[model samples]
Target: MKKDSKSLYYKDYLKLDELLSSQSPRSKELGKEAHDETLFIIVHQVYELWFKLFLHELDFILKLFREKEVDESNIGRGVESLNRILEIQQLSIRQIRLLETMTALNFLEFRDLLFPASGFQSVQFRMIENKLGLDENMRLKYGSSSYKMPLAKPDASEVTKTEKEPSLFKLVEAWLERTPFLEFKNFFFWDQYSEAVNNMLAEDKRHISENPNLSADEKTFHLKEYASTEANFEAILNEDAHHVLVREGHRRLSHKATQAALLIFLYRDHPILHLPFKFLSKLIDLDESLTAWRQQHALLAQRMIGTKIGTGGTTGNVYLSKAAETHKVFTDFANLSTYLIPRSALPDLPENIVKNLGFYYSPESDES
Candidate 1:
């Protein structure tokens, strides 16, 4: 079949025309004298775009979890989305290092033009902090989300400054709340069953169940306390009471599966003992690659401008070091410490590896 003449591509759906022409040079001198100014503009703009996509994908995962869709297929897909977000984050960090290639002199060429401008003012970044479970109320404490834009439209600049983006932490919290623990699921199931039993006992809803408030704890407690008041009536409701008592005996069993599931991710060796083990191992390699990127950024910053405060008024190399600490090579090995050879319990070895030849367990006496 022939394609429709009105068919629109992804770019068409987006307001690309507005975005494409959004960058403005400080001056003809800044644009012409500083050859890399355009590079600076595009790098930050591209980073913002990546952040936007990350927020979108993460929001999708949140909605899926909210709808009680936690089968293997959904979880697999959610993890895939998370992997993509992590990849994009790694790319943004690379772009930050790329800022080092150009001289601060080039940045200084237009530095006076920036006035109070700094990447520290990025609100999208603040939103990311909130998403990651950082205190949202503290954005201004660090100077992010409070800086005003000097050159953009009032509304656009205001939106950029004020809007708090959704984060992964919020998504996970929502997931845990709506997700039924086995205990809750069984309670809900039995509540329905108890209603049916009550109906059976009362031919026309006259004879309510022994515990009319089976679904509610306070009401159940009240009825139990008043049981002696209605001791004679209890005989009439003995069958229904007996049935509920029988179900309560197996209540723990019903909740056991869900409780066990809660333990698997962190308790039973989990992804540490599963396929994510391989992904984490590979990620360790990627960690080295990423650390190389950070080191490269520091070196590049030195090459461009040594020991100088960042244009955004940050202590350049020192600030980057703090950012570098946030990057973990992998997390699977992290949780394993609590379950296995905990880091706190591990004895510190002697400085020389050759001096401590018998550090590891002997194979013959290692296990039961």
Candidate 2:
């Protein structure tokens, strides 16, 4: 049979002609082309294309979270979508290695032609950060300049609008705050968790005091460290203390939301809680993976141009390294590990709660 007239052609469907034609090296226009300019342009263009796909998956995940009451059936789908973004980030990091193949000397041939036009002007990258809840205030200053200062007016306007929208971080925190499992009937999670945590800490103190291996100096040091650890724990267990940290900008999650997360973590084995646990874990992974990408990109920049300013006119790797550390958006979820107690130390949840956590079947039918 002849191919149908309506059938998709591989080149037409992917718009390969347009993509292949888009790379016109500035060095080539200047009458002495840098052989590596094509590689440089192509790498960044590929990153932009990947950014487009990343936003698509991220948009779907954000939709699922935007709901007043999240549909449980869609959670796994959201997580799978997030995993795709995570993979893309990994790919983004690996692509830098490919860029590295073009040596610094090769980069120098045409680097000046692109002056004042830096990767800092990448609007799509800014969009991803804004969508993921990177606060503008948290952004490192590029010499008293907003990051958007480099973008064209239209691009800048688009990024500004993203700030008004609820970010993924905001939505997830709200969902955690509203988690129903925190308080049920007589199952006051904080009360039990506090008691367990105190008991666990007291046991720790006993070991440190009684251990024959520790000298008096070591014992004193350990006790002071224990007090510090206990204070850190109190910062979570006490609402007033939690609020104080929030006010100081050291913590972001609300007290109730933090407590809910701690409880879910402690009893993650419960069937109903497993999904939430997975969701939290994925966010942490995504956050860390993205940070790793930023650090790698910074290193790549440093290798390409040491201590010099970026083509975007910023203090190249310095700006990037600071951004990597400060740009992270999911610290609250990652920090929850500090609150995690051993499985043995977790308070036994009520039987009724445990049964409700998973599907249960009755041996006898209700109909007689």
Candidate 3:
């Protein structure tokens, strides 16, 4: 055991004096304090603290991805980091429930004092979005102004710099592009997978055509819908077509990255691939959690002040709801399930590749 030269006090260590004194509600400042104002201030302060923790974890994950080759242990660490973020996001959603307990009238007691200082001005939240690679062009604009328009100049500059840096989405896509199991000597996976997909679609068409219960019009409609799904899978099989979708902003993951991701998903049961698969799954989970929090916040705002303009001057619930629906960073990865086939329908990997994708641990090998 090691002992420091000077003993540290608990209050001094966490700076409790500074922290406990930071929450001076505006209603208190106005000489008539409201009961709910303390809760409002504390809730927001807790969120900012959690946001700081998110950035700390994100910095480590980004460092791992920036390396030329990430180790397997590092991938596990990255998954752990994402898992922490997921937990934090769940807390964020739950905090809304706590805020709602203040009631609409309770909120109104101090809400006017918060004029021109809404969640839109939260620089930390904007930083989280930018670092996760929310596309700038796709953002829900407020009266033709940038989302950053509400930020102070210094904070706005930080957001701008973050945008120029490589985001988590781009880094993950690049890492997936460098994945090894997608191709093997004399055994390309995509070609075989494409053939399987065609056969599956053909079987579906046959089933639809032979169904006696379906009217001719219903059958025709189902066939058309089936065709659309087949064409989408076809786009994945064709690199040039995938590129066209990327150009149109309908997709963000590169063709190589998308293929590698699909391969991992299709063969996730392999011992070596399981961790990477979990990492990808965590990304989708993180995105979904954040979206849930955003929607919860929007609904809370609507409940507090029906359709009114935000304290920050934007259309309150409308802006938040639109952002909740559209502001996703891992949408492309989630949509990859559209290309997934059942385990039975998956194309079997070559034997050598299966070995490569497995973590063999025989006694002889371990001794060696």
Candidate 4:
């Protein structure tokens, strides 16, 4: 048992007095206070607090991936951090529902007091986005200017600095590229996987051509659709084609990294791969949760203002909607499902490789 030298009071420990006193709404300062203004200020302040927590968790996860060889236990811990982030993101979306409790008419009571101070000015949120590897070039312009144009010089500079750092996406990609099982002696994962995919595609084509239920026109249409899907598989199988997609901004993950992720998804049952698979899945979950939050925020703004400009001089919900559509980080991981084959269709690994992938123990025999 351990005892503190000094007794700690809850109020003093949390600085509750300072926290409770920080919510002075602009409407209140203007001599005529609006009731909803207090709620507005509190909600935004709470959002900033959650943003801070996101950065804290992200910093830990980033550190794990930055190592030359991340341990399996560290990956498990990273997955746990991602799970916390996803839970907080869900709460953030629910918090929007709470904000919606104030009607549009009520919001108007104090909305005018918040001029030129947009959510775009949230430096911490921007840092979170950058740390997660949201490509700055892909960001939608904020009212004919860069997203950082709305921020104060110091905040903008801080965001600019964060963009230069290696994000979780980059580090994870590097880690995946270093994965060992992609090639094991005489067994090459890509060769086996590609052959299986071709067999599946050939079966699909035969089915489409021979189906009695489909008319000639329907068969033609289906074959065209099948060809498109087959081309997608081809792009991944061909390194040059994959590189072309990367050059054109259609894909973000490098070819080796993409293959490694697919290997993880396809062979997730392997004991050694289970944690890596979970880690990758959690990244996709985090991206999805953020996208949901952004979409929910956009809807809330649309409901509150109805096509009006934002107090920060942006185009209100339109910009928000566009950002929601494009600001995704781990979509490549999610899209790996496109190439997944059934466990039954997967190639069998060599005995040596299987032993490496598994956790097994056998007592040795001794002869006298």
Candidate 5:
């Protein structure tokens, strides 16, 4: 064999040296930090690894969404990715609790050692939000000294070439714009769903027109209404394809993605989709869990560091509590359902079953 190029070895290949050297202990006595500081560092590293997986899944799902053949099958992939994302989130929740096991007394040993560090700077977490189409203007953060994202920005907006593009949300928003109006309108609950979406879009447009401070990107999004549908819209649902997407989306590995989409789809469709509330109950459970996690995190911080400012530069427990409160799950949608269900006729069920089944909505019945 020809001699390997000198660059092919350690220099050009794996940067193992740099990677291994990244973990720098603050004190000479590495083992002296109480309450498993090594475990703390390792756990955070592991969390980042999971977030990386989420980013991968999100990218793949969004790509599927963009294809011209977008349907339940493609959407299912997004759902599966979502499910995997949820698994990672569950692990994160558990990891968060690991902090509770250690008292502030124990943390004090390594408190000073952990100079400027907090989960606030998690780039991968931001990537997940971007992929899901959450607001990104204030969300994106890089070093104040540097103008560009160290990693590629998923969305391209910044003038500075040094700044990487923005996140996948930009791409998803564009994809939504390109999506054929007929195809989106063909889903089971087309009319009402389209109405809700249009309403939201209309509101967005008004806000854009009136608001002086709206960013250029926000204005562009509001001005261009990509999806348009009439109130009496009726289109063929590719039953086979739809089922395939639903099944794929519901795959255990992609629960969160599926859940998020389904939540949106159901709300848009309203009484039309008529999916079993039992199916939605799972999402409700997840919402409860997320809320609980936030509560616990706030408590843990309060107990550990008291009223001190966080390493992330905010009032520790107070800031954390507000962050937790912001994650309200399903309050708006749940409220909306009260109006939708009673106005429509109930689905056929066994006499006894019908009598016992409390007022509930099922998405499955919307199939037409």
Candidate 6:
């Protein structure tokens, strides 16, 4: 049995005195002391705290992926971290409901006092975005200036540092590219998968053309849409096409990584790939949760201010809506569903490959 050398109190341990005193509503400072301003400040402060925790979990995941060879156990741990992150993101989205509780008129009571200081100025949020692999080039400008324009010198500098670092997206792509099962001896997963895709597309086209209920124009329209889907599948099947899409900013994942990710998705039932599949799924969930939060925030802003500009001088909800549409990071993983064949159509793996992908007991080894 052991006790701490120095006794600790809950308030002291958590610095509750400092944390509780940090919420200084601008309305109060300006002598109006709006009742809802305190809630407004607390909501944003809580968001920043969650953003900090996000960075902590991301840093751990990033470290694991940075290694030359990430152990399966580490991938499991990374999946656990991502699960926690997804939970936090869901909570963040829910918190917007609390903000919505304040009426537009109530928000305006203290909103004017928050001039030139919008949620756009949150440095930690920017860091989180950077760490998650949001491309700098893809960011929307803040009223003709860079998004970093509103941050203080030190905060901007920290964000710049994070931008240069390898993001979770980059690390995961590298890890996927390094996946060994994509090509095992005579079994080339993509070769088989590509054939399956072509067969599936042909079947779809046949079904569309043979539909007895469809008119000529309806068949034409459906055929045109099917052609576009075929082209999308071709982009992944052809390395040069995939690269062209990457150069055009239509895709973020590299060709090999995309293929490996596809393999993981198609064969997620394999024991060895279960963790990787879960990890990738969580990443998609994380991206989706953030998008959901952004969408909710945009709605909240529009509800609070109508078409008015944000206190930070931006176009408010318009800017947030655009960012939500474009800020996604793991969409490629989600879009892999486009290429997935039914289990009935999936290519059977060689016995040896299946053995490698599953855990098996060996009585002889145990006897030794």
All candidates: CA RMSD in angstroms?
Answer: 21.0, 3.5, 3.9, 4.1, 15.9, 4.0
What lDDT score is found at residue 292 in candidate 1? Answer: 60
**Clash count (model 3, backbone only):** 0
List the candidate numbers ranked by TM-score, top first.
2, 4, 3, 6, 5, 1
Which candidate, 3 or 5, would have the higher TM-score against the true structure?
Answer: 3
lDDT of 4 at 309: 90
- Residue ranges of candidate 2 with Cα displaced over 4 Å: 1-5, 211-217, 357-368
How many steric overlaps are in each model, in order? 1, 0, 0, 0, 24, 0
* CA lDDT scores, all candidates in order: 0.48, 0.86, 0.86, 0.88, 0.49, 0.87
Flag clash pairs in model 6: none
- Candidate 4 TM-score versus the reference: 0.93
**Candidate 5 lDDT tens digits, 1-368:** 34475536753366778756655555436656454676567667877888788678766765765565444445445556656766766876888777677778877878887766676556665445444443333322233432123324542232232123443434433433332221222332334444554565466467777788978877776566423322111111233443454365321212223323333334433432223233234334444555676677788889989999877666778877875665443332233232232223322222332232222223233332
lDDT of 2 at 266: 78
What C-alpha lDDT, on a 0 to 100 scale, does residue 352 get in candidate 3?
Answer: 65
Put the candidates in lDDT order, highest first. Answer: 4, 6, 3, 2, 5, 1
lDDT of 6 by residue, 184-302 (tens): 66889888988998898899999999999999999999999988999878888999999999999989999999988988888888887788889999999999999999999999999
Candidate 3, residues 236-308: lDDT per residue as tens digits?
A: 9889999999999999999999988888888889877898899999999999999899899999999999899
Model 2 deviation from the true structure expressed as Cα RMSD, one decimal place: 3.5
| Number of the candidate with higher lDDT, 1 or 5 | 5
The C-alpha TM-scores of every prediction are 0.50, 0.93, 0.92, 0.93, 0.52, 0.91
Identify the runs in model 1 with alpha carbons over 4 angstroms from their true place.
1-16, 29-32, 67-69, 96-98, 136-167, 170-262, 265-303, 326-333, 341-368
lDDT of 5: 0.49
Pick the winner on TM-score between candidates 5 and 6: 6
